[model samples]
Target: MALLYQFFTALWELTGAMAPYILFGLFFAGILHEWLPENFIRKHLGGDTIFSVLKSTLFGIPLPVCSCGVIPLAASLKKEGASRGSVLSFLISTPITGIDSILATFGMFGWIFTIYRVVTSIVIAFIAGIVSNIVGERGDKDPAGSSASPIRPASFRADPPAPGQAGGACGCDGGCGAEAERGFSFFEAMRYGFVTLMGDIAKPLFWGLLIGAAITVAIPENIGEWLSGYTWLGYLLVIAIAVPMYVCATASLPIAASLVLSGVSLGAAFVFLSAGPATNTVTIGVVRKMLGSRSLIVYLATIVGGSLLFGLGLDLFFDTMQIDPRSVVHMEEHGGWATLLASVILWGLMLRFLLPPLFRRKRRCEGEEDSCCTKG
Candidate 1:
């Protein structure tokens, strides 16, 4: 009973610390969704040049898409004639951090960690993109090196079919967000942020919170102090799980912070934050299909290698500069009324979206598909 109480207490505190920033971030995410020109990404990311790769990395920074969500968007870019490097860049960059994620990261981990995350993601993304371009020029190119080679798959070069056309495996996620056309309204933007975006994330957020609280309650305190000498092992462990997992950027924070509180080095936590949101099995298959085998290798190698390198660099900087990671960790256990209110509101919103589908599933499970119990 005491253990249960401690678990719930930890969960609520984590929620209180993150709820307000998440709401603020979601509002801005909606604003970005509506205001950013629909064609802006497509227009600037077409060329086979360094600038195009650079632009894609910058553009992906503010997007709120997760690793899975970004796959189709990246495929659409590929279909729209964006260079391979640019597509890979967008894939790598969009998922690891975003506006919603940035705010939550700062609220929980402080500005230093937040800034470092953003910076390192951008650098890793840019480098991955540049390397892809180089590999494309050498290995995936025409004899003249002026364009893509004939050996490239036909599906890779084909444009997606027009509306209602669904024949090919290529550009599969291209229509992932093809909502019916509607006039722009501020209210609608807020609806997307609060309702649509929140709904998409609610399940993962719930699990992250539950798992984080459980870790906090279960792990022995200061275990990290003993594990400090094996930071490399920690990094490897984080990567092993994170790279194949499907947690979204915002959903990953509480788990990372809890790991920190439970004696995991900050660098390992950073690894989970960086690698988890950006790579997963589905995205891996999509990369191979849309980009090719060579590009897939570049994509995976860059993210895994780069995340490890940056993770180590972060640890070195902290030790060399005598920075105490715990001091910067901002897990607010006792917040004001605003925080409590936001936590309640956030939970309510999550439940509103999460429970209905679950209830329907339960009802269906209780009876046959044609039975009354399965009826809506």
Candidate 2:
């Protein structure tokens, strides 16, 4: 009971710190969705060259998609005129960090850490694309050969998940749907952010919060001090856990914070941040299906290797500067009325999206499927 209470307390505190930024970030994601041409990225990334890969990476960085959410969109790019490398680049660059995740990161960590995360994502994504183009096959010739893209695949084996599926839960956000009118509407943006995108992530966000709080309760504070010199162990452990698990960007912040409190070095915690959001078991299957076994290997190697390399650099930077990343943490944004209100609102929204399905499932299980369970 005491452990359960502690877990809830940590979960509430972390929610207060993260909710405002997540709300703002979701709105910003909607704005990006509405403001940009629906086909803008598709139009640019259809090339087989490094430039196509770069564009895919740049465009993917700010978008608020998770590892799962990115699947259909990447598949679409592959089907349309995107090169395999471009598709691979898009897959990697996205989900490592998103706008919502970035703000939540800044709210929890600091500007320097946030900046490093973004820069590292860019570098890693670009390297993966270039490597893919060099060694991975050109699945389809693009416009350079009077076709569409070298970075784009001519054909992908598996179809993206259907609309009601996990990856397609938010109407596939930017991935599976046809182009929306590029004209911006404030109402549409709010609906997309608060309703569509938020709905898509709400369930995971709640589970992530529970997991984070559990981590806090499980790991003792300042245990990191003892492991300070064994950063490699932290890296390996995080990779082992992160590569198979799925955590969204915003959802990952509190989990990372739990590690930080447990004396996990900032650099090692960063390995979790970078690796957890980008690679997961489900996504591994998707990559293999979309790009081939060879590209799948390249994809995994790049994310795992790049995460380790960048994580090491981050630790070195702090050590050389005689700084402790833990010192710069800013989780004190909690305990205010404003934060409490935000947490309340966030909980309300989370429940709104999460409860209906469970209720409907119950109805179905009770053999009421022909009744209102049908609507659900």
Candidate 3:
């Protein structure tokens, strides 16, 4: 019972810390979605030059898409003439750090950790992009000299459309040109921010917080001291766990914070933060199919190796500076009324998206009387 109370308290505090910043991040994302044209991404990433690779890295850094969400966008970029290097860079950079994630990192960790995360993500992505250019297969073309279609397998192609594309009658796709054609409105931007983007993240965020609380309750504080002598092992373990998981950038924060509080080294926490949202089993398969096995190798090597190097550097810096992780965690707990209000609003939005309406369910049952009645 005490453990249950601790778990809920930790969950609420973490949610409050993240909620306000998340709202701001979502609004900014909506604005970016409304302003940036898809063609703009395609235009800049078409070349194999270093400039294109850098552009891809920088452009991807602030976007809010998760690892699974990014696959379709990356595929579209590939089909629309983005170079292999640029595509790899975008894939690496986009999921690991975003505006929302950055803000949440600051709220949970500190400015210093947030800066390290953003810098390391860009460096890793850039290195991966350059290596991919050097070794990856040339453009998307088959040996028969025919243009290859989307790299995703036909079976996997049915995943939801990229966030800003038309999916249904709402015309909620944030394509600027489409908005202009239909007459843009602020209400539409609000809808995208509060509805579409919120809907996309709600389920993942819930699971992330739940797992974070569980970790908080399950892990003993002494576990940190037990692993202190095995820093490298800790890093490796975190990478192994994170690499195949599908946690999103924003959702990863609470989990990382919980691990740190449980006495995991900050470096190991960094590894989880970088690797968790950046790669997953589905993402790995997509990269292999899209960029060929060679590029896939470069992608995986860069993320793993770069994450370790960054993690080690961070640990060394903390040691030299005599910084305490607990002190940083204490600093993050300054949330007040704004945080409380934001948490409430966020929960409401998440519940709205995650739960099916009774009216809609009843209507569906009525429409399928034979099946519904038989089940009843």
Give RMSD to native, each candidate.
7.3, 7.3, 6.7
Candidate 2 ranges beyond 4 A from true positions: 138-182, 357-376
As a whole number from 0 to 100, the lDDT of residue 282 in candidate 1 is 85
Q: Rank the candidates by TM-score, best first.
A: 3, 1, 2
C-alpha lDDT of residue 8 in model 1: 95
lDDT per residue as tens, model 2, 1-376 = 9988988888887898788888888889778766775567678999779999999999889887777668867876887767778999899988887888888888888888899899999998898888888777755323222122212111111123454554331223464434234356787666667766776678889988888888889987767766876767888999999999988877888888878766788888899999898989988987777777767788999999999999899888888999867786666668888888888989888897788765324333131112111111
Give the total clashing residue pairs for model 1. 1
Count residue pairs with overlapping backbones in model 2: 13
- How do the predictions measure up, each by TM-score? 0.84, 0.83, 0.85
Query: Compared with the true structure, what per-residue lDDT tens digits does model 3 show for residues 1-376?
Result: 8978988888888788788888998888767665565457778888889999999999999876666667867886787778889999999999998777888888778788888899999999999999999878666342221134332211111222245554321123342112122334566556666666676678899988889889988999799889988887899899989988888999988888888888998888889888888899998887887888878899999999998899899888988999876566632553677888998988877787677573114223232222112110
Pairs of colliding residues, candidate 3: none
The best candidate in terms of TM-score = 3
Better by lDDT, candidate 3 or 1: 1
Location of the lowest summed lDDT over 10 successive residues in candidate 1 = 366-375
CA lDDT of each prediction against the hidden true structure: 0.77, 0.76, 0.76
At residue 127, candidate 2 shows an lDDT of 89
